[model samples]
Target: MTGFVIRQLGPADAAAYREIRLEGLERHPEAFGSTYEAEAALSPEEFVRRVVEVPTFAAERDGRLLGLVGLARESGVKRRHRGTLIRMYVRPEARGSGAADALVEAVLDHARSEGLDAVLLAVITEAEPARRLYERHGFKVYGVEPGALRIGDRAYDDELRIRFL
Candidate 1:
């Protein structure tokens, strides 16, 4: 994690954010719900709006953006006690170097600071490394959503995990 900086992203980071995000969706279509084609069509202004609206954290090293993770809280009063962890991605070169760890920790820290009761996330059932990462951070699988995502003619299941703050 040395030389890596984990911080909240702003509007100025939209281009970099969009690049990394699209990379993730493109490189691993089965891992995310969003399609690369869908996101690629979005304008820079939309990314800027996302930067301002979502609580997203980015990992940077040597002035280059390496990864991103987003935290979203529920708007309903009854669901306000929880938040969702979304869009976690790290460049392949940065994997196992603690960049993913840093990004997730940043989200967990932010959740605690916001007084949220818990944070929930969904991982593709086949992604063992990601599941292990979340488990090591105290997340427990509560359920599995079979056929949660359908891409083309294939179906993918998602494991739902949650960690109480």
Candidate 2:
């Protein structure tokens, strides 16, 4: 994790986002709301627009992308103070390392800079390690949606976690 560059992603870095996203979806199919197949069909322009428009950060080492996280501010005037955390993925080799922590911190820093009051995320209940990571980051599990995601006939509960910035 040391010597890795964690920085705000720009238009040129859309490919990094796409690559890590594909890697994530392929490795963890039931871990996200989107599918790898659908997301893989997106045009480069669309990918660039989405990544550059939102607050996304990436970890790189030796000029190779290692991980990434995305933070999307809530829309509508009433929800201006809220943000959503999504698309957090670290290469398996980087797990238990500090790469994911750095990416999460970068997202939180971006939330604070954007004047957001809080950030929210949903973790599948069965993902114990991920739940612990969120807890360590000051996120509290406030609620759960039973059978939130149905992947290949299997139901998974979603645990909602939030933190005030």
Candidate 3:
């Protein structure tokens, strides 16, 4: 497939997006802090509501979801100018095909439209590709949270990144 067709996610895409998310968690449990079981147990309504709240985008190729990305605005009044990039996942088979890049850009565009001053994200230290992707997009590692997520017997370090829009 050529570049994936990227589109803003709507309420109707909740299930498809959820499936991609679960697949990502299953394939790379160490990359993300979330688990497949944890996401699957959430009701569809919850998924839809979450999608509605955050600006989400999906990449599709040949009718299959290739990637998804979303951002959540900070809740506190003083921190409302900031937003965090979350739920960024690309199908393992679709890596380097531009799907993930498109999804990330779409979400970042949404954040810019919302007048966000900066965006933040936590990338697992060992995920070199992921870290490089963010760096390519002008994100710099501000700090690292040691032992961020405990997955089974081991712990993963997370690097905090920030990009000013």
- Candidate with best lDDT: 1
Tens-digit lDDT track of model 2 for 1-165: 478889888888888778888999989877899999999998989889988788888888887788888999888999989998998888987787788888889999999988999999998999988888899999998999999889888999999999998
Candidate 2 ranges with C-alpha deviation above 4 Å = none
- What's the true lDDT of residue 117 in model 1? 91
lDDT of 3 by residue, 1-165 (tens): 575798888889889988888888898888777799999899999889978988788888877888888898999999999999998888878887877777778877888999998999999999999999999888989999999989878999999999999
Tell me which residue pairs clash in candidate 3: none
lDDT at 47, model 2:
86
By TM-score, how accurate is candidate 2? Answer: 0.96
- Ordered list by TM-score, greatest first: 1, 2, 3
Per-model TM values vs. the true structure = 0.97, 0.96, 0.95
Better of 1 and 3 by lDDT: 1
lDDT of 1 by residue, 124-157 (tens): 9999999999999999999999999999899999
Model 3: CA > 4 A from native: none
Reference-based lDDT, residue 92, model 3: 70
Instruction: Give lDDT: candidate 3, residue 53.
Output: 87
* TM-score: model 1 vs. ground truth: 0.97
- Measured by TM-score, the strongest candidate is 1
